[model samples]
Target: MKLSFLGQSYEASNPAIAATDTGETLTFRGKSYSQKQFNVALRQPTEELTYRGVRYHR
Candidate 1:
């Protein structure tokens, strides 16, 4: 899935927050995101699931 956070875009096969299968870090837009960022992103009301084109919280 493709998602945008903090003005950056990321692609992931799984969208679940803090998924261990995805490894310890998530790389997006040439940057690596740590668990804290992942948690923050998951908590954000704006986080979206690009495949479904809907906000994750809603």
Candidate 2:
């Protein structure tokens, strides 16, 4: 999956869910997510992900 925020982009394959001081996040592909959006993304299906006009899949 690929996610972009604040002009920064991150890609993760089989990302892992984690909890942070603020809320939940995901850690994958060397990036750590501490944003609510990332937590919501965890519920997304693995079949497809669209970020920054690009599509990703497992």
Candidate 3:
């Protein structure tokens, strides 16, 4: 999906988006971002992201 963050737009695809550090960190297209950044950028549900075998509660 297309998302905007920090006044920048990016195209995020499936499986490429994941989170670590207990949902504190988000990785997109090989670039690492904070959960807050991702949340602001993402227009879709957080459930669409792949976690570390755990469900993320945001």
Candidate 4:
């Protein structure tokens, strides 16, 4: 999966991404750098997930 934060001008490749509402602050990791509220949007759904032999939430 990949994540792009327009507010922060930052990009990341992983299952998750984080950033703040203000463009001044953002983080590629799961943590955000700005105090402003931020919204996270997933670009792609997980290909597959397993939980105790059962499929995880699609």
Which candidate leads the pack in lDDT?
Answer: 2
Query: Could you tell me the lDDT of residue 35 within candidate 4?
Result: 51
lDDT (tens digit, per residue) of candidate 4 on 1-58: 3456665443455444465566566776788676565456666654477868988654
Ranking by lDDT: 2, 3, 4, 1
**How do all the candidates rank in terms of TM-score, highest first?**
3, 4, 1, 2
Candidate 1 backbone collisions, by pair: none
Task: Give me the candidate number with maximum TM-score.
Answer: 3
Instruction: Write model 1 residue lDDT over 2-42, tens digit each, in one string.
Output: 99999988775444565343446878999987654333224
Q: Write down the TM-score for model 1.
A: 0.23
The better-scoring model by lDDT among 2 and 4 is 2
Instruction: Name the TM-score of candidate 2.
Output: 0.21
Error of 1 at 13 (Å): 2.4
lDDT tens digits by residue: candidate 2, 1-58: 8999899887866646654465768898999967553242254555677879999984
Runs in model 3 lying further than 4 Å from the true structure: 16-58
lDDT (C-alpha) at residue 51 in model 1: 52
lDDT of 3 by residue, 1-58 (tens): 9999999787776544443445577789999976642222344554444368866643
Give the total clashing residue pairs for model 2: 0
